[model samples]
Target: GADVVHAHGLHAAARTALALSGRSVPLVMTWHTRRYAEGARRQILHLLERRAVRAAAVVLAPSSDLVDRARLRGARDARLAPAAAPSPRSSQAPHEGKVRAELGAVERPLLVAVGSLVPHHGFGTLLDAARVWRALDPVPLVVVAGEGRDRSALQQRIRDEELPVRLVGSRDDAGELIAAADLAVLPSRWEGRSLLAQEALRLGVPLVATEVGGVPELVGEAAELVPFGNGEALARAVVRLLGDPERCAWLAEAGREQAAGWPTEDDTIAHVLSVYDELAQPSPHPR
Candidate 1:
């Protein structure tokens, strides 16, 4: 008999609660992100989310926004447990030049955006912004590294508009790609402690991200933040940061400083283990 069951994501927690129907085992849920479903699917998810939050003995969230969300969904106890991004692989540093040349960003500025090619990820907004960069000398090359159902449509727009953007599909060397760029863009409509943001800052690469969800809390003043879904603001921020070499340098250093304040992998493990220990204890008055 398990003493505790830990489930991650809304769906997993809901299903786990259903599976544990008549059991006494305590359940711990971790809310990662909200499902971007719509209409009937959205309503169904809302019901499931409520059930999951209410059923969990404790809900762990990676960001403050998510903690609030869980509480709103009826979680009795929710705690902030920031997820740590894995440190960049040291070997990737040596191949930076090679990556830039391969991506055809050797002479021009390289902007890297890593996320699924989906609507909520806001890659479309990024492409719209890239259109503005066409007039610049040595136009920046925007390379998105991920794959999803929205790939075909995004690719079509890139070609139709003659945008300097390329869908590189999914790559295992995302860290390498990010490290090799002049700037890293995170145009997502929402995020909870974005791994790309963490990696970019850690590598001393300047970043421009949307001010949504936990991003502001995560990056603070370390990176340039613009309103979500605003292509002009996004483009302006990127251009301004690129032109101001001094600020970009300052931001790079500030990014590392900010990243230093985030929870480390060991810290995350210790915190989670403590939660497990607390939950495993027998109640003073057994039910």
Candidate 2:
């Protein structure tokens, strides 16, 4: 155990570090996710994170965006680490028809976009694109989970657009829904790297998402990228996935392969411990 300790995110890894630090153990700090692009409120948050960041033995970042933000907030030396991706806790095999049935989606083709209803998550863009898809062939069902202050407005947008969508806000069973989906998407304007996308890829759902932040870093060949806020392009990709069953199946399988090879929950624990180890290690050149 390190003389000082720190951790990031809400997972057990962060909690463990906090618990150890409570015994007067020195724990460093890490910030894995932040609100969004900088503005007045963001600057205020940056100020707060900056204050917290300076006390850490070493700051850790799970995505380049977060790394950059931490650096911007004065965490210049925060170590960079890929976000630890945990596989589905139980059986989550995706059957063609059965999985769709569970989600109340018909057996045509399903394109799921998972994220908060917030502006940063791009749920509104997703709904707008889905409206375009309504006129396209083999229309998809967009199943979104997560809740925020924008939930009501997003709901109104859904009603206004008349999109084929299901808004399952703030759920624990989101993984099962991801498994049931044909594709998983994140339409966020900015992101630190979406945990939702990681989980979806782990379940091997085909990914149609935007190119931003660490998303491109993790999704690699598994996703079709579009510019952020280009509803037309995003809509086209969804339609493409929906129209082609063979391709959808292939993408789904490919996504699973990529996500399965990613770090496990235990791996997250190991990485976090390694950070603590570095903080505890003897410095070659010390004051």
Give the top-scoring candidate (lDDT): 1
lDDT, candidate 1, 1-287, per-residue tens: 88889999887888899999998888999888866788999888889889999999999987788899889988999999868878657562657889999999989999999998889999989988998999888899999999999999999999899999989999998988998999999999889989899999988999999999899999999999999999999999999987899999999999999988888889989988999999999999986
- Per-residue error (Å), model 1, residue 22: 1.9
Which candidate achieves the best TM-score against the true structure?
1
Q: Please give the TM-score that candidate 1 achieves against the real structure.
A: 0.97
Q: Which residue pairs clash in candidate 2?
A: 3-26, 4-26, 4-27, 5-26, 5-27, 5-28, 6-27, 6-28, 204-256
lDDT of 1 at 66: 82
**Candidate 1 local lDDT, residue 243:** 89
Q: Model 2 Cα displacement at 154 (Å)?
A: 1.6
> If scored against the real structure, what TM-score would every candidate get?
0.97, 0.82
lDDT of 2 by residue, 153-246 (tens): 9888788878787787787767777767767888998766577778777666778888987888787788778889989999888777767878
Assess candidate 1 and give its lDDT.
0.91
Candidate 1 residue runs with Cα over 4 Å from true position: 90-92
- Model 2 earns a TM-score of 0.82
